[model samples]
Target chain A: MMKGADPDAPRLWREGDRLHVDVRGLCCPEPLVAVLRLIDGGEAGDGLVAHVSQEPLLLYPELNARGWRYRLVAPRGDDEVALEMSRPRA
Target chain B: MTLFLASARSRLLPASVPFRFFAIAAALHVALWVALIFAAGEFTQFRGGVGHALGAAHLLTVGVLTMTAVGAAMQLLPVATTRPLAAVWPTKTVFCLLAPGALALIFGMFAAHVGAMIAGATACAAGLLLFAGLLADNLRRASSMPLVRAYGWAAFVALVLLLALGFALALDNSLGFLADHAGLALVHMILGAFGFMGLLALGLSHVLVPMFALSSAPKGRVAWAGFALAAATVAAAIIGALLGLPSVLAGACGLGFAAALLHLWLMRATLKSGMRKRLGLSFVLVRVAWAALALTPLFGLAALAGWGPGGTLFGLVALGGWLMTFLFAILQRIAPFLASMHVSRTGGGPALLSDFSAAAPLKVHACCHFAALAGLALAIVLDNAPLAALAACVGLAGALAFGLFLAGIVKTLASGKI
Candidate 1:
């Protein structure tokens, strides 16, 4: 289970080897903080995916700082996006 | 994926776009205090007219406040709205027109040159209208953040009225057409300070304060109610000033006080619930600005009651104490934050926020700034010119320290030390 995960928070689940987060309706920093929590809490798996409504521009810097790489995994919709992220290999 | 990346990149404008405005605002912040030093003799007695005092006021209003607001909005709005600006050229054109226009306007005021004042006002009005058009287009397209959008629209309306009144005031300097020039001038100040800038500040706070604190935004009925009351307050205040009715003005102040309390409560809750503790010195300044904001209406009421330099004190607190202080607080954070983003985007690796911030100068600035505000307030109470001049000198020192803080950022970036 994710550390200090709130049941009422945005949906997060695991499937196979990947952790998935859905933060579609959340506002800025909320969406960003959700992902950062997963990363900082050491809950993010080798493969992680996030579904977000906005592009999460502010998140890119934090990801960069943490040595994570992400790429769009789904075709962009008008308001939906899915990004596949991975930890940098040691 | 490539298209997505491109779209994301488009949300952030070129570094030069926002930085130009930030740089100008920094320089003018220093200039404002210097101008105030010369105008200190008139600080207490100043009712409404053109002179060094007015020049200094415009420097803060047009040069620093609006200049910074335009730049930040152009850069941040695209990101927040999830839409890119139609083009960058218009943003550049706004800076070109508004910057020189502001300088000319201040010069004209200081020298009492009606011709220069008219020309400057015209250019400024043109520049602001163009910016307003851009804001409206973005707001029209925005699908999310309805609360911010509502505030943005209200502020937009206020800006339009402010510009029209501003231009008329400039013309009246020569033509003298208006019957109640001074009253209209007071209305112009209220619309500009509280209406346009105040609403924008309150609206942006919903986004900015949360983002900085790493907290969730404030929303729901309370936030909306706060907005409604604030809008009502501005409307009532304008009508009151225009009609020369003290009761209406008092009612406006009461509305404004309620709105301020609600705003402070919202902010306090936001901060308390935030994950990030110890938000650094910028937050200290932000808190002070909030305090100043809360006191503004009380000062206005006192002014109406003819209490102890209340009118001048109210103006000072409203403009310098609340707006200018709040602006500098945010500017310190965003300027470096944006620079870090740009640095990372340009393949400069992850540039830490600390790398671009110099704590020493900022500490000096904070101390001197608070001291200067206190000194100036005391000076106003006593109606002492030399003391006011001395306080302004302290303010100038603080401004210069702030400038050094900014300069350090540029140096770090230029030297590739980050």
Candidate 2:
């Protein structure tokens, strides 16, 4: 679980081996930052699933820079998307 | 909404598309200062009409400001709206038409050549109309970012009017078709500066400022209210100009002041709430621009009241101090940001923004830009041509430094060092 985060910040929870972040209501860099925070905080092998209302186009470069790979996953509904991300293999 | 992975790549135009405009804008920035340096004497005494002063003004407005706006919008609007441009060729075509056309137009104004002026005006009108159409298409598709869309639509309307006015003014140079040339010229300036550029800057800032600062956009009714006031302000100012009514213009300025205050307050709150406290040197320019934005209406009121050199000062502060400064500030950031994005997409992992920026040149640029603005302001107030020339020299130096900063990015990208 994400700790001491703002109530309006993205909601984060764990599902077995993966962390899920609901970033639907967040704007711009907030969505990008939330995902970055999870990557920075988690263990090297931990995986993340981010739910976003808009596509995070700006986040791709940051993910690439940090050696993380991401792909679009099945969306939850008509207005939300899930992006699955994982650290690069050694 | 169905999310496509390919949408990411689609949203970002090829690096060449935006960078070409930036490169041309950088070159024209240098040319503008050089033109000013030569025309500094005329600049100090400039009471409208045509000549080198007019040419120099267009160099900044069309060559630098509009060029950069087109490039930035082409790249950014797509991403903001989550839609790719229908085609990239039109953008290239716009560049092809506007760039040389702007040069020809400026040259014609400087040399008093009607033929070049007419030819250039036709080309530029064609290019700008195409750009407006493309922008309209994108704005129509934008479901999110309602405030930005609203402003975009307003600015689009302003752009069309300005283009029409500009074309008529250009033709009037030879034909002498108008009874009140100066009056229409004033209307053209107001439409171009406040209507098109002002609204665009305000709208884009809502997105760019927050994105750069890592903060949420200033949302809710306050933001919407600011937009409403700004739009109304522009409309009132245009009507006042067209009718030659100082009282109406004064009222417009009052509305403009309120709008500026609301805008500055919103920006201040946005920065305060930003996660990234240190927004870097580019933000210093942005802050200066915001100050100019606040002062523009005050200057307008002074101009209306017939204060010393107030009319010229109003034009300078609004065009040079606010719009040009803001564009350069944003350019410094977005150029690198876009370059880095392109570099990242090239498969060898992401490129850092620092790798694309040269700090020393930018520092020199910032210092010299402020000095030139201050010096020019003083020169205009005192009607001192020598001082104006000196200020233009300082501005030229700053423009050179900015050009070097841009050059460094181009070099790095070309060298594949990023």
Candidate 3:
């Protein structure tokens, strides 16, 4: 059996002033892929936060290139830090 | 907002720079195999000399290995370091120098042409020096990822040593100035194969393997130990070779074996803990590469003990069985990956990686590659020249198949179908 395979990991949710895309158990391109999927599915407005377990910095290029603005937030308690992303108004 | 824009532009190079290197590397892969096919008779008995066999070896080393490393490092290393390349023009100029320079060097080595070898070697050196400069600049700015940074720094120092020795060896052919040409050559090979390429592979695996498998990165201490041991092994091996110390060389092999095993253990742990269970066909090749890496030190020990054909076997497995296989596997994934990223950035909507890659050519290549590795190893073991030639033919076919795969990706991109 694969270790650290959390099948029941949180996918995403919405809270006050932000839609939380929880990728806390994921790694690398998964986080980026999830974020991109959300953007592609017409969730490109302000207030989408992606919580990635590791290496969230790699997402910045793709985010910025796709016209999304992001600010990396430090972790709250034991949670992974969040990348809060939004497309800027013209 | 301003920071985001600046960061994005800082990290991204013109896609053409890296893609061009990849194109050259893919083409050269086929070219090297073709060269091997023609030189197959000399290949089995090759112990190191300037001829068809030497040409083929350089075609693989300078042309394919170095070229691919340059391309991948330029694009991926920056991302790992969180620093942009100094500029794109130097990279473009590197390809300009490396591509033709590699060809000329191969031609010179094959035909025993002194002037061409010198000229080609000089051009190649110049290109590599520029690359080293860029790498150093990027690494200096890399404050994070200390293990990766250490690997880069070590590879940089090794590059400097290899180039210096490489130039002397090339000149020795014409001038006979060096008293110990063979000794210098051994050190050059060690530094080139292990110090530069091996270190990069170890370091990048920490990031690349996990990224692909969607697993957490290996812990820092394990990675650091691997690096330190690998460095010690390479240094000890070089010293042993120069000073003719068998015990030291054997100890180096032992250290190398440990380092490789530790690395594979970490990779295994990563895979086990990975979110992505089915990593696809590319990873099969990666596994083969890892196995080859693990077995390389054994071959080295055999060579040190003066076993028949052990030295040749070590070279074959290290170069062909491990480095080539690993690079191709990564290339298989990255070409489509980078292309998808490019498409998305270019307003093509989220491009699926599967959309950019076709399976047929890759499958064909994978089959042929495995057959080639196994066949060549058997042929070497049995001292069978004809079988070795046949193996080279099989490898050539595989390389061609890989080329076709890359060409398909290019075509897909050109069609704006992403």
Candidate 4:
């Protein structure tokens, strides 16, 4: 489940109250930009899962530094890792 | 996310996938050219007359043109997005499929191999779908440059339409969807040439013309207008075709494309005014690109004027004259830029642009090549096969010279000028 930051971020999708974007096969800036666009559009919530490949080691630290609360979700037999991210309550 | 900027070595290497495909495509172009030359003078056996226009032209236009454009976009969009490729295997797979597929498709045309043609189209469409997936990622990213964004989006849509049209043509030829095949060739040209390739070129030129020249890009409405006019004109042309409205609309659209070029030329003038004072042969090459831009409109003029068999000449003007000449001009910049960037990133100091330029023979060849093309255009105007042949022979000489010059460039790069 993914989480929203501002609660005003546009809801592209909802797992109940959370905005989730399945960023599987989605590369950088794409995933981030889409999320930001939603946020900027007055949509926000919890459980924003940005599922992406963890091949680039450089990507994760940047996400963490941005204050995104993320949990890495790993599935069996798949090369991809899903980062379940949520915004803290303001 | 941080903006995507190319690393040193990455510049030299073709963006992981398309470079290999483009290489294969260029090889196909050269081989098809060879065949066209051989087919001339003594081969009446071909369904069409013996000439470069018959086989090589199709292969060059479709195989080389589309392949290179697709590959460049695949590589470049990632760079723009600051995104790495989705999957290496799929990218490689696409190239592997498209290369042999294009050849088989072309051969399939002459051999009446309906199955092969259908198979080739399927393979290519699959490859393009993969490419589109990658590009979609880029388009999703936020960019301040709306013109680039708009053009990128339209190019993808145009690509989808072009592929659909290609499928229709393939099915008609293979499955006999329409036995007569009404103006299918013209439709293919309109969609592929004007819609897909033209828009891609125009969009990318907005980047390349400025970047290589170290000039300020064309901003504001002029850039957007160019994109809008091209997209609208292409759509109108296609609509006119379907409606049986008038051939004149097609002429109008072509004139509109010429107008787009005129806009670009003016924008290029703007780029020039602000460029670094000590620009070199790359600048000269860019000027040549401008000259080619002029030819694109001249082609539209020739088409509009209803000159006899002039469409063929006009096609060459747009295809080889504007597109190929612009491609080569950019290549001259790209090749050296790549080498220099690689060397510098690894700690080599500044180097002269002339150090990498293809001097002597390549220069001579370029002159001959342009002259040969001009002569061929003139011959078509005169409707003289003998003169066309003479021009083609000269063209062949120029091609050989270019090949030798390319070898020299490689040699110079390997020598380490820094």
Q: Which residue runs of candidate 1 sit more than 4 Å off their true CA positions?
A: A1-9, A41-47, A64-75, A86-90, B1-9, B344-348, B411-417
User: Cα lDDT for residue B147, model 3?
Assistant: 75
Best by TM-score: 1
What are the per-model DockQ values?
0.32, 0.28, 0.12, 0.03
lDDT of 2 by residue, B358-377 (tens): 89999999999999999999
| Candidate 3 residue pairs that clash | none
lDDT of each: 0.86, 0.86, 0.80, 0.58
Look at candidate 2 and tell me the lDDT of residue B377.
95
Interface RMSD of each: 4.2, 5.9, 7.5, 13.5
CAPRI-style class, candidate 2: acceptable
Per-residue lDDT, model 1, residue A52, is: 82
Q: Provide fnat values for all models in the order shown.
A: 0.19, 0.22, 0.07, 0.01
Q: Write the per-residue lDDT of candidate 1 for residues B190-294, one digit (tens) a residue.
A: 999999999999999988898887777788899999999999999999999999999999999999999999999999999998767889999999999999999
Docking class of 1: acceptable
Error of 3 at B140 (Å): 0.4
Highest DockQ model number: 1
Question: Least accurate stretch of 10 residues (summed lDDT) in model 1 chain B?
Answer: B1-10
Distance from true position, residue A84, model 4, in Å? 36
Model 2: how far residue B387 lies from native, Å? 0.9
